[model samples]
Structure formats: C-alpha cells, structure tokens
Target: MMKIKRKSLFTVFLLSMFILSIVPMSAENVEIYSMEKLLDMYIENSHDIEIMELEYELTELKYQIESDDLDNKERQMTRDKDDFYDTKDNSSSQKNIDEKRDEYYASAKAYAASTKDLMIQEFEIKNQDKYVANDTAKKKNSFKNDLWQLYELDKQLEVLNATSDLYKSKYEVAQLSYSLENMTESDLNQALIDYEQMVLNSDTLINNLDMLKGNVYINLGIEPEGEPQFDIVPPQSISPVNITYNDLLSSHKSNSLDYEKQSYSLEAEKVYFDILAGVFLENSDDYQENLNNYKKVQLDFYNYEKELDQMVLDVYYNYQKTIDDYNYAKDTVELAQRQYNEAETAFEVGQISALDMDGAKLQLLNAELTYDQSLISCAKATDEIALLMDGISIK
Candidate 1:
C-alpha cells in the first residue's frame, strides 16, 4: 500500500512538471493588429489600472457600510439597553436612553455624511474626469506617434534593402576587377574587403528588419509566423525650423504625462493633509500622530515637485538631441548623394580603377546607412518626448 501511494505521488509530480513545462513562459505573444487596435486592447487588459479601479469600488462599498451603520443607530441603542437593564428601572433608563439615542443619531448622521463625502472626493481624485480625458487623448496621440515611428522604420529598412543591392553590384564589380591579369595584390585585397563589408552590412539590415517585425507583431497581439508585411506611409516632410531650449521646455511642460501625473500627485497629497488634519485629527491617539502625518504629507509634496522639475528638464534635453540628430542626418544624406554622383562620373571617365570606384560606392552606401539610422533615432526621440508630455494615445 505504501509503495503504491509513493508511486501515485511521483506520477502526479511528474505530470505537474510536464504541464508547467508546456505552459508558455515568454510574455512575447505574437499578434497582428493596427496601432489603434493594439492600444485599445492594451488599455482594456491593463491589470494595474483595473486593480486601482477595484480599490476605488471597495472604498465606495466601505462608505456604504458606514452609512448603513449610522442609519441604524436607534435600533442599536434599544438593543444595548434591553441586554443590560431590568424591568423595574428600565422605564427611567429608557428615558435616559432616548436622550442619548437622539444625540448619538445626530452625531452618527453627521459622521456618515462626512465619510460619504470624503469617499466621493477620493473617488474623484482617483478617477478625475478631466485627468481621464487628458489621459485618453494622450494615449491616442502616442499611438499615432508610434505609427509614425513604425513608418519611418519601414523606410529605413527599405533603404537598407536598397543598399544591400548596391553591395551585390559592388561584389560583382570586384569579381570583374580581379579577373584582369594587370590587377595588383593590394587592389584584389581591397576588392575582397569591400565585398565582405557589404555582406556584413546586408546581414545587419536583415536582422534589424526581423527585430522590428517581431515588435510590430507583439504590439498588435498577433501570432508571428512567416514574413511580416508592414504598410507604413511616411508623414509629410516638415522644414527644419530653429526651436530653442526654452521652446522645448515649454512643450514638455504642456505635454508631459509624467509631469501631469506628478501634478495630480501633489494635489492628492494636499487632500490627504486636509483629511488628516480635519477628519482624522479627532480619531488620532495623540497630537504626535497628527503631527507625524502632517510632516509626511509635506515631505511627499516637496519630493513630487522636485521630480516634476527634473522630468521637464530631462525631456527637454532629449528633444534637443533628437532635433540635432535629424539635422545631422539630413546633411549626411546630401553628402552621400554627392559622393555617389562623383564616383559614377569617375568610373565612366576611367580616371579611377574599377576597384577604387567600387570602394567609393561602398563609402557612399555606408554614409546612406548612417543617415537612415539617424532618421530612426530622431523619430524615436520625438516619440519619447511625446510620451513624456502625456501626448501618446491611451485608450
């Protein structure tokens, strides 16, 4: 019997382990979706936000219970007297109880009303209508911004693909150049190096494309299988305008979600102080406890203000960097185009050897890649700034 029981337990343990092993451990579930659809699903399924909502509901319920207890004050007083008093003095004590009950009823009603009001206020703070509206708008903007970014990334990938083709052409040219008996060992070595570099670059581009596709799948809640197609329309080009540090700071202050949340936090802390000082003062054991709570609120309020200021500064700096990078990339692309033109002219004139021309072509390709990469960096930086300002799309 003992042996059988042990065998059964061992079997159950093995089964449990097998089940655990089969369960999906990676949070990176694949799914296909548009940017808007993905954001909607994320908002609906956000466990953290739901938990906050549950806490608010629980508070409302607690307030209701207190309200009910207050309403039953008279009945409770009568029950208490019945349990304690004898029939003889009961009539006299009943008169005393009636007076006490009226006083208790008035106080209970006041307390219940106050508690209900505070609870409603807390609910408003937790789910402020204006804040909720702002948050929703922010989330929507963020989604649109992300979509723009994805579009930019797609363009970069296309550029990389084009560059890869250029590399293939260069490799072919190198082969032809090496076929010439007049080619020096140094010339052949340079050709080989150019071909190898192009191959490596093409491989890097393919890897990046794969990674971006995976991210898109995850964002859309789709199963990632086979080749992913990203249809991204580039935004209309905007002229480069001089934007100052102050302008960036202003933008961040107006748009940053983190800053807005911190502002709300400060307001909440003030409300907490008011409640602790006004309502909870009487309930507190001593002056010391009240003083401690007051100090804590002050400290929290100070910290929140500091945090908001720092966030504003950080976002402003990031935005500036993004703008600078975009400008630099624009210049680099122009330079690359000029170089490619020069190389083509040189190759046609036969002034430069095929190997040298190929080297120049590879250089132009690298420059173009760098320019595309910079463009991506700028877009990402813009998205980050938007998110900070609370301008992102949220459901």
Candidate 2:
C-alpha cells in the first residue's frame, strides 16, 4: 500500500482569522484593505472551500450507510456459520460437508475484504479536513502573490502617465513649431502619434487594473465598494536561499499534487487491468483497453519527475534573477537621486537652466519606477521560493 504523506499547512496561523466575523463594507465609504485583510475576506467568501466541506460531510454520510449495511451482513454471516456447523455435525457424507464448508469460507473472505475497505474509508474521512485546509492555504498564497502583480501594474501605470504627459508637451511644442513653419508636418505627426500611443498604453493598464479588481471583488463576494484602496507594500529585500536546487526539486516532486494524481491513476489502472485479465482473454477488447490505459498512465508517471525538475529549476533561477535586478535598480535610483540633487543645487545658484533641473527630475522618476517594479518582482519571487523552502502542502 502507498502511504499518503500529509502536507504542511502554508499559513496555519492565518487560518485563525477565519473564525472571526467579517463586517460588511458599505459602497458609500472608502475602505482600505491590507493584503492580509483582503485574503481573509477572500477565503471567507470562497465557495470552493465551502463545497469541499460539504462534500466531506456527504462522504461521511455515505460511509455510515455502508458501515451499517456491513454490520447487518456480518451478523447474518455469523448466524449462517453457526447453522452450517450444526448441519456438518449431523451430516453422514464427509464430501458434501467439505463442499459446503468451502463455499462458506469464500463468503467470509469477501466480507473481510469489504471490512478492510471500510477501514480505509474511515481513515480518509478523518484526514479530509487537512486536505481542505491545504487547498485554502494554496489559494491564499496564490492570491497574495497576485496582489503584488497588481501593485506592480499600478506602478507601471504611474510611469506611463508621466511619460504620456512628457509626450503631450513635446507634441504641443511640435504643433507650435509647425505653425511657425520651423518644424516639418511629418515631425508634428510623429509627435502626435507618440503621445497617442502613450495614452493608449496608460488606458490599457488602467483597464487591466480594473479587471483584476473586479475579479478580486468577485472572490470576496462583494460588490464594488467605492474603489477600495490597497495598503500593502512589497518587501524590498528577501532572505538568502539556503537549500540547494536539487534538494528543492526533490521536495517539490515529493509534494506535487500533479505527481500524486498521476501515481494514483497508474495504480488504479493496474488494478483494473488485473480485474479485466481475470474476466476476459488477453486479446479481448475490454482487456486491451485496460492495458492501454495502464500503459499510458505508466508513461505519464515516468515522465512527470523530469517536468517537475525543470519547473523547480526555473522558479529557483527566477528568484535569483529578481534579486539581482532589484539590487541593480536600487543602485541606479541612488545614482539618479544624487545627480538630481546636484542639478537642483546648480539651478538654485543660477548655474544651470530650469530645463536641466526638470530633465534630472525626470531621470530620477524613471529610475524610481524601475526600482519599484523590480521590488515587486523580488517580493513575489521571494514568496515563491519561500513556499518551497517551508514546504507548503499543496493538495
């Protein structure tokens, strides 16, 4: 028998909040939600978790009915055995008694097999809550990560707005120059196109943010509530990785639900094939189908580890790259800030034009945008790697 390994809860402590009552937010008032608060609301509103709990209850009910039926059958078998023993004692022919005894033994063996199966069912029922918790944890982690992406998108939109404004100013200048016959018509047209494209990009990002928020609201089982504010900020730095890549891959493979599902399917098909072999010839249609299914599942199971290995490698390397990008961005921001400060001083002393100071300020803004974007990436990547490090039970 293959043992089912229990998965560790990703955020067990956070689950304590699930017991607390949720206050409904009014659409009229603005409410600021931290990532943690939003996650609590999402989990509380989740129909998936509720459905899983309901299914577990239904399974328990089914088990009870089956158990009761088995108990009745066992009592009947006991009575039948007693009667058989009595008949054997009074029988004159040994051969007739021996044949009847063989039939009774077969029936008893089948009863025992069913009882063992019920025992396994009882075990599954006992552990079903853990599975539900694991699933909830997975959703919570994934949703929290999504919120960071939305944060990054919001930052990108801010940069796009600034760039659009800059382009708009240039377009206006080009139009003025063209009116004076100093700029070519084609040049003015190019400036207008650039400004329009920037505006379009900004609008697309805004729409994407709204779409994501809509999905979030749907998950929270809430209507749009006056543009709820996001208060969570991504961490700028993460802890260093301690585990080797190979070890990480091993752990991921061991805990992967995909691998588990494939393994179960392979085992089930093998059992089916054995049953078919007993009932039909090897060349029969039913037997051949069963054999094919078993072969397919077997192949899938064999190939699964390599796929998982590659996936883990990508996640590991992505984490390292995000960290490197963030550090470089941070350094660039510092350099830009220093140059902007010098430009400001020069302007104050009438050593440089106001235009030069403005240019320096724009450089700083762009650098900061890059830093913010990389910060979000680093935070998300750190979370992903940490999930593997902590061994979050994914069901």
Best by lDDT: 2
Q: Tens-digit lDDT track for model 1 on 14-56? A: 1110100111123366333433344565455444445656655
The estimated TM-scores of all candidates read 0.53, 0.69
Global lDDT of each candidate: 0.52, 0.66
Question: What TM-score number comes out for model 1?
Answer: 0.53
Worst 10 residues of 2 by lDDT: 1-10
Q: Can you write out model 2's per-residue Cα lDDT over 252-296, one digit (the tens) per residue?
A: 657654455555555555654564455334686655765787688
Worst 10 residues of 1 by lDDT: 1-10
- In angstroms, the error of model 2 at 326 is 2.0
Misplaced by over 4 Å in model 2 are 1-34, 58-126, 221-227, 254-265, 277-292, 349-356, 389-395
lDDT of 1 at 340: 78
Error of 1 at 293 (Å): 4.5
**What TM-score should be assigned to candidate 2?**
0.69
